[model samples]
Every structure is written in structure tokens, then in C-alpha cells.
Target: MRRAAVGSCPASKRSTLSLDDHAVGVGRARAQVSDVGRQDDPNARVGLHVDFWTVDDPDEARRLLAMGADGIMTEQLRRVATRGAIVAAMVRLTRRRFTVGAVAMASGACGGARAGEPWSEEPPPSRVDPGFMPAPPAPPSPDPRLAFAPVARDAAPPRSIWSWTTAEQATEIRRDEVLFTRESSPTLGRGHLFDVLDARAADGDPAAARLAGVELAKGRFGWSNPWATVRGATPGETYGLELLHIEMRPDTWFARVRTSHEAIAFVDSAGNAVDRGAALDSFERVGGILFEHDVEYTGACATTGSGGGGLIYREIYVGNEARLATFSHRTAAILARLEGDIAELSAFRDWLRYGGGDGWSAYSWSCIAAQLWRSAPSTSRERYLASLAFATDPYAPYAASVDAIVTELKKASFFTPDDPFTHAP
Candidate 1:
């Protein structure tokens, strides 16, 4: 079962908090930082829906403390935390909240019902008459099909079609195969990424504009919408979308759509977004399509350092790798679905690589920076490799959270190469 995280606030720049109708009893005392948001709020769960998570080192964010944000998700928090004493104080206060919770729980020991503690005054029970109720009927025989009764050693063959695909058989088959996808995996947290995607797209409909609900509009392009922000993920509640494959051409600028996750592919001529082995329902759930992100010999992205359009992931639009941009014309955005999972990052990268129609030189693994491999952290580091392993086979061992991925990585006994932002490389 999924549980929401809640905690107190680190001594945030009280000024940054907005005491709306939702937050009663929270008082004001001429707070300091006006843009703190919930980054320093101890009560804010790390995976709860956020308006936005900014990455640009703006002077506006003077300082902050991280709460439940996974390591990959808390880069913003660390950036603000490094800002001298005031921010350090905030971090300290935030970490201290856990201690406070522990202390409170410890103190609660004395308030519980103990063996020696006296009970409240009890009342006496009333007398009852006989012959008031009837007895229950005899139990019925259990059905062998649905019941947990053992199979007879000499029993005849089962009748149901499912007998051919029993749980044990299914597990063995999947173990033998190297690849398989299921409806079980979910996009992190947000059930529908399309909901966020809608907020990010620029639509003319008055109803859509009203529903988009923006405090500040960024042209017709919903590029800068906070809700659709690009960042590491948390588990999504509903399995909103499933991207099977994208169609792209390696030779010419001209392209066609057909489907296959096996190689670079796209939708078919008949408008069928079908894959050989992928379920059609999952394919239709794709809120959008994905592309590849391969390069060789220092491409434009490596050269110019531009953030190609997509936020939340390998930004390529306004950077050196200008070719990393995506579009709805050649590409498709999944609507009303969440496709979040560290494991799925590879697919997204593939989508980026091929969808943008940049002439590929060669498939160079080194081009994919080490940082791209960094998984979501458990305690200190994220489990990027574990996620990739999960991506290879999400059904193999099941992923619980970012922590689960991290634990898997730890079990694999591999080293995580560090990527320092030295001189903004």
C-alpha cells in the first residue's frame, strides 16, 4: 500500500511560505526568503505533487533544506543548502525534525496502557434470554478450481485455458526470456503524465486555458510549466501510459512511423501504433512517443550546452546539443498517463535520439554521460544502474521505490562513478 509522507518544517525563510486557506494556524513573523516554497517545509512530502522544481542557480533561492526528496530529486535543495550559514541552519533544522519525531514517540511510551496502569471504571453487563438466535447451516464443499485444495496426484487434466498459463509456468517462461513488459509498472507518482503534459502544451481552447491554471503564462508553448517540470521520478499510482516504440529514419530527414522497441522504429502506415510483442492497450496508453539520444564526436549538445526542450530530463533545446529537441509534428506526447520510472529513462533517451531527426554519426555509449547513469539514491546515492536493470526487466524482482533500486544496485556490488559539475561540464 502507498503511504504519504508528512513531517514538520525546517526553520524556513518563513517569508517564503504562503499562508493560504489551506494552511491555518501557520503564523507570520516577517519571514526572510520569499521564494522558499515547500523545499524547506518539513511537512512537505518529497514525492508529493510539486508546482515546480527549479535547477537554475538563481539568487532568489537563498537557502533551503531537503526533506523526503530522493538524492536525484534534491539537487535543487543541495544547491540552496550550500549558501553559507543561513541555509546551513535550515538544513540542520530540517534534519532535526526526524530527531524530534523520534523523541516524541519515545516520550509517548509513558502515555500508553501499561500492565500496572489502572483501567477506567467499567460498567456491568445486562442479562440475556435463551432461544433468541438460530444456528448456522452446514458448510458447503469447496470448489477445487478456486479453492486452495491440493491437486490429486492422479487427477485428470484441468479444463480451463489458464491451466496452460499458470503463475508458476508464467514465472518460468519470463525467467527464460530476456525481455518482457507488463501492465504492472506505473509512471512514478503522477498517474497521468498527460495531465501535466496538458499544462505544458499551449492550447487555444478557453476551457483548456482555464483548466491549465497558470499563474504566469509562457507563450503558447507550455515549455516552462511547473507541473510538467523535468526531474527524477517517484512511483506513480496508476499505470497511466506505456510507450512501446517510436518511428524514425536514420538515413534522410524524411521519416515514417511504425512500431518496435527492439530497434529504431515508428507507427505504421495504417496509423496503427503496434509493436510485435507489446500489448495494443499499453501502446494506446502512450501519452507521447520517445526517441533516441545517441551522438559521436562532440555534437551540438556537447558543444553549445543548450537545454533541448524537455525539462525533467536531458535538456537539449537551448544548449550545445540543440538537436535534442522534440516536437508533436513528428513525435507524439502521451496524454492522461504517467510513464515515470528510472528504468524507463533508456526508452526516453532513445525517443530523444531518434525523434529529433539529427543525423546520427555512430552509436557511442560514452556520449551518454556518466551522470545519466546515476540512479535515484537510497541513503546518499540514487540507483541508476538498478533502474536500468529494472528497465531491462521490471517484472524480474519488482521495484518498491527509488530506495529499492538503490538496494539492488548495492547488491550488484558495482561502483557508481561520480560526475562533478566542475566548470559546468
Candidate 2:
């Protein structure tokens, strides 16, 4: 004779399936299954199947299956049978005034009963029983700070695939920037190299714009007035310079060229200049230019700067060896950032479309944003800005909120989980 016990208790507190070779019983208590009673048990007393009872939630059923349960007994046949339709419908409902919690309850109850509670003869509450649960309050209005304002199509182009910078590429870029800044002079004559490059940049030469932007950012060739230098330059030039200024050393040269819009210096929470990854920022900005221009360069093999005196003229034809290296390195970094941003955005969008309707998706988004705010607020801001530029309609609100929150976060010197600015909500 084989024995089994079927019981109900808080799923978190106790198991619902128990079996042995003796007698069968059902009650609200902790389950005890012997190895011999399990079908998979090597020393088997009986070939017993482990099944859970009264599982109304499809999510719970899935969880049980993962835990090696043989079968599940769920009352709501339609919900379990039409899981896809229910989830899709819930997504539609979430767009309305109904709270995510309400939709979750309408699908299925998460737990069987409270711990130590006795089973009652009364029937289980109806899955959609309005009488069992009060009407959920309407969702709060969108935060004023996160209010969506559509940017121009030209300004925020559709998302595109991008690759990450490799270690070798990064090393090459750093080497180039350092060597170029040391060896090359931005002067061709009294007029300066920028005078010609600036005109070329205006004429839509991405390479020229990039070179000129880097020189202007470094305050080379007697370049003063950051805004004035870039005033007539291309959009790529302006953005590239802005990125450079954000991480450039704040010295006499930087001071002479820094715009009012640019930060005096990027610093950590302790007010110390963040120098550890500063070089990477420079590289990334340069990379952005290359990506915008859709240009490619081979690594160190691409340029020969050591040949002879004709090197200066060769640079004018191509680009400064150092500048070219930095360009390639930074381009790789920009591609990496884009790749990460796209992956995160895709996952977020999927969550919005097919996430559990128990408000966990929204909660997780807030948590991730908060974590990024604490660890890398600037990165968070840049990511959101990218998201705003690239995200589709379904996820625009989330991106906008994060963008707004970054502004608030920038005002604070330190961060805590409880900080109001840490989360978009």
C-alpha cells in the first residue's frame, strides 16, 4: 500500500506534495516525501508522481515545473489554456486606468492560503470576483518632469546596430592621442590648421570636422572661444567638442576655450576629478564622429607617421597619425555604447510587451535606473538621452523619465536608495 498527502499552505512556507508507501491523506501541514516514494529515487518503494494541487497561477505552474513537479492541478482552465491571450489582454489593460495589481489578480492568485490557516469547506474566491477585492485606484498621472516632448526626426534618428570597441583598438587610440598631442602642432601658418579644417568641416568633411574639433577642444593652434570656434561647424563637430570639453583637463587652455554650457570638470561624489576613465570618454566622443560619418580605419597599420619630413603634408592629405588612432579608438567605444544601449532598450521594450502584470516590470525599471543613478549617474543620463533619441513609442515614457531624473540627480553630490532623484517614479 502506497501513501500520499495532499495539502495547502503558503507556497513560500511549505510544500503541497508528500508521498510514502503506507496511506494517503490531505491536510494543511508541511509535506514530507521519502526518497523511496519519488519516481526518480534510485531506491524506490513505489513509482510516485510529484504533483501540486490548487495551483491557479500559470506563473506558479511554470515555477513548479522548473522544480521537477510531474503535474499541476489548476482550477482556472481558461487562464491556463489561453495564457498567451490573457497576457496580451493584460498588456492592453495596463495601458488604461486599471492598475497592474488588478490585472495580476484577475489572472490568478499567487499563494494558496496563509500559514497555519485551516482549510475551509467554502469554495475558493472567484478569480475575477470584484467582491473579493476592491477596485484598484487609477494610475497616477505621468510626472511633469518626464513629460514627453517629441524631438525632430533629424535630431533623433531611428536606432541602428553598432559594434563595441576592442581592447587593441582602445590601446591604439590612446597611444595615438598622446603621441599626436605631443608631436603635432595644429599650426600650418599664422592662420592655423583649424582655419582650413573648419572650412572643410563646414563643407561636410567628417574627417576634417573631427580633427578640427579635437584641436579646438585641446585649445591648440591658439584656438579660443569654444562656441565661436564651433559656431559654423557641423553638428558632429559641435557634439564632439562638447564631449571633449566634458572630460578635458580644466587648465589655462581648457579655461580659455570652455563654454558656459560645458561642465568645469567631471568629478566623482567626493568632488575629485574622475580621471580613471577620462581617456575613454575622449575616445568615445571621437568614435561618435566616425560613426556619424560612417567611416572605417584599420588599426596601427593604417598610418605611417615615422617615414620622413613629408609626414606633415601626408597628414594634411589623410589625417594626423595620432588623430586617426584616437578616431578609430573612440569610434569603437561609441559603437560599444550603442550596442549596450540597444540591448538594454530591446529588453525593456520586451518587458513592457510581455512582462508579468504584477507591477514587477515597472518596479524593476525603477530599481535599475536607481542603481545606475547611484553608480554612474552621468552614464545613466547619456543612456537615457540615447534612449529618448532611439526608443519606440511603447518605451518613450520610461526613457523620458530617466532623462528627467538624471537632471535631478546631477544636482545632488551623493546618492542613496531613498533619494527622491534616484528613481524616475
Candidate 3:
């Protein structure tokens, strides 16, 4: 693979290159074919585009994958390697689905896997809990008690989430939040919530089930009904949860969110989207940003830099800070402070390019910090670190990056050499 020098493309020249061989050759060094599903020109197609916002079911994943996609444009990249988890879920969905033709075969155990239902050859389940399709989502209470907060779509659906998938819950959120409506949910008014379950079944590893969801508990970090035994999971039981990207790319793994629709982002390297496998929960194109939250900001962090362990440079504040502003319309103000007379909502296309500026990872201290902040009554740096993106990597170089930037700033007369300078991550 190859890496291009940043900021090499000019705007005026864009009209000249739709699928430029030279540009593609540059990308070929890295073995990449950008789909750019979120661009302004709907007519513009570089042979493909991917955005996880419209889909959140394993069925959707299967569809995209069938389409021969290279990569899913999603934030949840770690779920791709969940073949093991998928196997476990299939076992639960169809007991026979786990036999030779199902789980055993998918695992490459040779003779065990035969030809039948839930086979690796078969399609993934799209809809679970037929009756519990779309739940009532949470209302955007816009409570002043917190800073910048987003309520869950199925936070309190008219019906119970007991038989609903997290995708269904997410549907509710998109529909109700006039500002956040989606094709999946037409109701237009509700919030969706999820729970996380880590339970064990008496016979086998329930967590090992395919398309399975110990599922997440609503309004809380964990689950309420710990176990819904296979014997108890009747013909119509609803279940769903957001699977967090525990690691990105090279180490694809998901921490599994106890919430709705986070799973939709999982796609195989072949670009084959998995159904009911993962679901897209959010999509907003306010700033020409096909920016991926689960993709651009997975739950990973840097071990050798100022940001470590899930230490994604992406900062989401509950309060009205410039960080949230960057993701919000406030983004307009901050960029205005930094650049020239560029003012359309699409200006974010330029900011997206700035991603080279920072990064974080899951299992890192930095990720821990982010969670801590989101869960606070009154947030702080220390508390944020508790559940943030800082990595346990021994050589966190926030100081190093700071020093380099400081040196440049000093040279530019922004600060005097002797000035007492401090760098914080």
C-alpha cells in the first residue's frame, strides 16, 4: 500500500478527474478505491460509494457485500472479523443451523459443515422479531441538566424492546428527530436505547452465538435480563446491540455496544455487507463530511503519542465546547476563525482532510476518558481519563507532538522561546 502526501489535490482540478488513472495509480499503492458515498455530487461515482447510515442489519451487510464493495464506509470496522460471533449466533438462531452445514462448516472444520440452513453459503437474517419491527424512540428532551446530549431512539418505545433488534430501536430515533430521520424509521418521533449482556449459557457459550445479542440494557451501561436461554427464546424474541470497534483494521474486533444499530457498520474486506450482522445508526451530511463516527473514530487509541488506548483525537463533549461545535453547525464558526472567506455548509470537506491531525484507539486510556466524560454529572479531565482513549502503550508521545508543534509555533513568533509552555492531552 502507499500513502499520498497530504493536501495534494486542488478544487478546480476535480472536474478533470472522475476515475483518473493517475490518481487511481496513486491509490493503488495503498490498494484503495474510494467510494465517497457522502459527497455533494450524487452523480459523481468513482465506481462506488459506501455510507453506513442507511443500513444496520446483517441482511444489509450481505447486500452490500454481494454488490462487491471493497470496504464499508462505517465507523465500526472491527466487527468484520466476527465470524466466530456470527457462528455462535447462527447456532442459537437455528439449532440445526449450527450443525455441519452451519457453524461447524463456517469455521472450516471440514466434514462437520454440510449443506443446509444458516450455512456460510446462505444469507444472514435481516429482520428478527417480526412483530417488534419499529419501537418508539426517545424524545429529544434537550434537557438542560446535561451538556450536549443525544437521547436513544428506543429509549422508551411505545412497545417493549424485548423482541426488537437494536436496528429497530435506531429506526425510532431517526424517524422522530425531525433533524435525524432515516428511511428505516418513518414514525418520525422516538428514541432508541440498548443494553450490553455478557452472560453464559449452561450448555454452550451464549456469547458464541451468531446474530446473537445478549443485547444491551436500556438507559444503563449493562443488561437487565442477563440471560434469555435458548429454550426460553421462543419463535419471536427481539434482540439487538451496538458492537463497538475494539480494534481497527489490522486487528479487527468489536467491544460490542450494549446499544442499538452499532453493528451495521461491520463489512468484510471483500466489501460484502453482512445483514443483521451490523447496522448503520446515524447519518448527517451537514458539512460535506461523509465522516464516519464508527469508522473515522473507532474505539482505538495510540500508545506512543499524546493520545493513547482508544485515544481517538475525536472528542465529543456533552457541553457547548468547540469540539462538539466542530461536529455541529458551530463547526462553521471555528473554521471561519481559521481560514479564508469559505462559507458554505460543505466547507467541512476541507476539515475532513485535517484528520491527519489526530487519532485514538479503543482499549486505550483515551477511549476510557471519552466515556467517562459522557457519563459525568460535571465532567473533568481526570474523570474523562478514567474511561477515555489513552492507550496503555508505554510511550505515549503527546508531549512529543506538543514539543514539535511548540517549536514551530515559537519559531513563528506565536510564543517566545523562554515562555513557560505546557502541553496537555
Highest-lDDT candidate: 2
Ranking by TM-score: 2, 1, 3
Per residue, candidate 2 scores C-alpha lDDT tens digits across 1-425 of: 22223223235533132122111122111123122233333222311122223223456435544644312221011121111010101112223221111111111122222333333222233423332233333343332222122222122111121112224433443555431232232222322345555666687755455545644343222111111122112112211211111122122111100111112223222233434245234533221121111111122311222111121110001112232222222333333433343344444323323211222221133233222222322332223322231121112223222232232223221222231111010
User: What overall lDDT, based on C-alpha atoms, would model 2 receive against the true structure?
Assistant: 0.25
What is the TM-score of each predicted model, taking all chains together?
A: 0.18, 0.23, 0.17
lDDT for 370 in candidate 2 is 22
**Each candidate: RMSD:** 25.7, 21.0, 27.6
Kindly state the number of residue pairs that clash in model 2.
4
Residue 366 Cα positional deviation in candidate 3, in Å, after optimal superposition: 6.6
On the 0 to 100 scale, the lDDT of residue 389 in model 1 is 13
Candidate 1: lDDT of 215?
18
**Which number leads on TM-score?**
2
> Model 1 over residues 1-425: C-alpha lDDT tens digits?
11112223233211122212111112111112222334344322121111112112222112211322222111111222111112111111111110001101001112112222222221111211122111222232221121111112111111110001123423433344311222112323222322433543454433223222331121111111111111122222211121111111211111111111123222332334445234222332222222222222234334222123221221101111111122111012222111222324333222222221122111221222222333222311122321221111111111112333333323222222231111111
At residue 176, what lDDT does model 3 achieve? Answer: 47
Cα misplacement distance, residue 116 of candidate 2 (Å): 18
Off by over 4 Å in 1: 1-184, 188-308, 311-408, 411-425
For TM-score, candidate 2 versus 3, the one ahead is 2
Candidate lDDT values, in order: 0.21, 0.25, 0.22
